[model samples]
Target: MFCLLLSVMRRIICSLATQLVALIVVIINWYQWDKEVEGYIEHKAVLCEFMSSALHEAPASYDDIKGKYVFGRTTRPQFFSMLHRYNVIQAYTQKKEFVWIGISARPWFIGFAVLQFGYVSVFCIQLYNTVTRESWKAKTTVPLFGWLFGGKWVSNVHGSVGPTAEGHSVDFSAPFTGQSAKIRFVGGGLEFDVSGTVKKVEGLPSRKPTLAARYELSGSAQLPKEFLGLVFPLGPRRAAVVHKFSAVPLSRPLSVGIGEGVWHGMGHISMDYTRGLLRRDTRWCWCTATAPEGYGFHLSAGTYDIGGKSMENSFYANGKVALLNTAVGFRKVFEKMVKAEEENIDISSGDTLRWAVTGDGIDLQFACVDSHNGTVHCGVVDGNLNHSWGIFNGTITVNGIVYEFSDVPGALEQHNMRW
Candidate 1:
């Protein structure tokens, strides 16, 4: 019927241009003229009141330059243990990709990402609220990928006002170039626009809800950009400014309609473009998955301008990449991961928390199951992060075979933006 009347006039002109940009973002969030989003929403509402005073006790007294609405000139405490370089000749590159349209027996988990830096271009819509362990994100930044030293011609609209996400209550991160990271084309990609809601906070414990789902993910990816890639740099100026990853999935499953739910599984995507210069007070541990000889792994025990070349311990399987030379003590493997919740003495609430890592030959085992710790305002000063969604049990011998895993699906992280 004439293409269903041009898809209902393009969904009524994109819902009246998203209700006129949500009525001009409720009048610029009531005139808070963007001081890097009023110092990241007053440093994430003082880290959400220090994460609700961490469920009971802790986190009082914090004043390093008036709680970060924008800070620098960290009063050189003797050059703060020397080491601060990320120039890579005026670098500031970026490139991205993310794909996880899952199905481990149905019940949905969708994520489609994209990004291109310098004169901006971003999109991220991640949803994995399969009834708890909450997550429903959204992001958008425009300028449509301009180039040549990439700057100027910008636009923004950040998210999370619901879906149990009590962070980013309208920030514009003004005066620009504040890349606290936080993807491309294929078989027809790039289309998203969904807006908020996921209440439950009046008195907590409704599985602790208070998130907003303001997603606007777009897409595109169909191979060839070297089929599966990498481009190293983790030192000097721009201390690790280029990480190109390409996940090639989706040969079978596909069914969509998120919000009032309807999503199946089996999907993988990728896009990565990065331009350097970022390193100031660090602590990192980045895990990636969807395996079979390799499609992820990035560990860090330290990186202050990747000085001695741990280059973020690399390993990307099946298509190849093996960069590793040092840095993997993860602070003595986090003392064997804080003894994994005291050896999971019968972990309740949809349980799953087991940890292991062994020998100079690696004998790993990780089964997370669920985790979503938060405390935003990243890039330092009380910026915690623990976003885990599990499944990684047994074997990993690589060229020596042994590669085994039953529950498969993966993603595990541990972050502390210099806490």
Candidate 2:
């Protein structure tokens, strides 16, 4: 009778264990399914609206104007709607307001529930480890995965700006002139009530081969709490943070070398200024000056979104004027190590009229010149190789003439490092 009782007890214990295992598996599958479904639904809605708005309507703005006209496909509200759809983010919209959200998950809860179950199926090993004093590896994988998936979210209200206008031109001295203001990317969740001025200096016939001047440009953006690490990543899974405010002042002047023909100073001079000249010629040359007293010219302002395989190159003789539109193609020309810096860099392309630009940087090798007495006093800086501090060298070729510029100044000091 005692032996029979022991057999029945063992059977009951085994049955209970089996039921527990089944229940755990069901729960795990259900949780994963739920999270995935939620993510999918949210992402679909966000992408649809975001793309649609960007293609059809003028970009939305924080404030409304009575008669001003704007053009773009997306609106501010539509953009926010996409962000709100994400479970990890919360969006807030208010006039003159900035905000951000923070998100993360608990480590311990994820561990006990998700990682350790794989070993549970090995009943014999479990039993042996429990009976013998052998160490059983507790699943520590879940907690590590949780930490990797979790992060903080933040936002801010700071002075910011975006691409307000898109067009082609030769002179960018006053590109912002008459152009309505708008915000582009609002990373870092910061906002600012900022204002700035644009100045211009025209090239005079009596001046020497070069034109020069200075300008001051200033603005501020409001910062949100811990709203860093939200910028568009420069590389895969890698992010940069804005640790502090950067302000830069620029100062620049144009220096031109007179060539043959009726060319006045550095740029082409024609009796009648025609916009179609760029289409016929392959190279051009011009110069410009900055505004204010000490500040330099800044070429950081403007947008260049060329279709794949081609690059957009522009020169600003004055603000809002385009001198040359050169199509840039990239090719490997040469590679060598700089002895002084101990760095391996390439001087990619052969000396030719072809222009090559990388990412946000621009490179323009003058392929044609049509301006007559167009001695425009424009800012000259190396837009391609310059760092955020405006420390780099650029090569320019005009009508079979070549020139090199380095450490060129711009309108805003903060923009010195940005190309």
**Against the true structure, whose TM-score is highest?**
1
Candidate 1: where are CA atoms >4 Å away? 1-109, 112-116, 124-237, 241-259, 262-275, 278-287, 290-404, 411-419
Deviation in Å, model 2, residue 30 alpha carbon = 14
lDDT per residue for candidate 1 within 140-192, as digits (tens), equals: 45543423322221212232111111221111222243321222121333222
Worst 10 residues of 2 by lDDT: 103-112
User: What stretches of model 2 exceed 4 Å from their correct place?
Assistant: 1-84, 89-327, 330-419
Taking all chains together, the TM-score of candidate 2 against the true structure is: 0.24
Candidate 2 residue-wise lDDT, 59-161, digit = tens: 3222134221121121121211001111111111100111111100100000000111111110000000112211111111112222222111222232222
Give all candidates' CA lDDT scores: 0.37, 0.20
Error of 1 at 259 (Å): 5.0
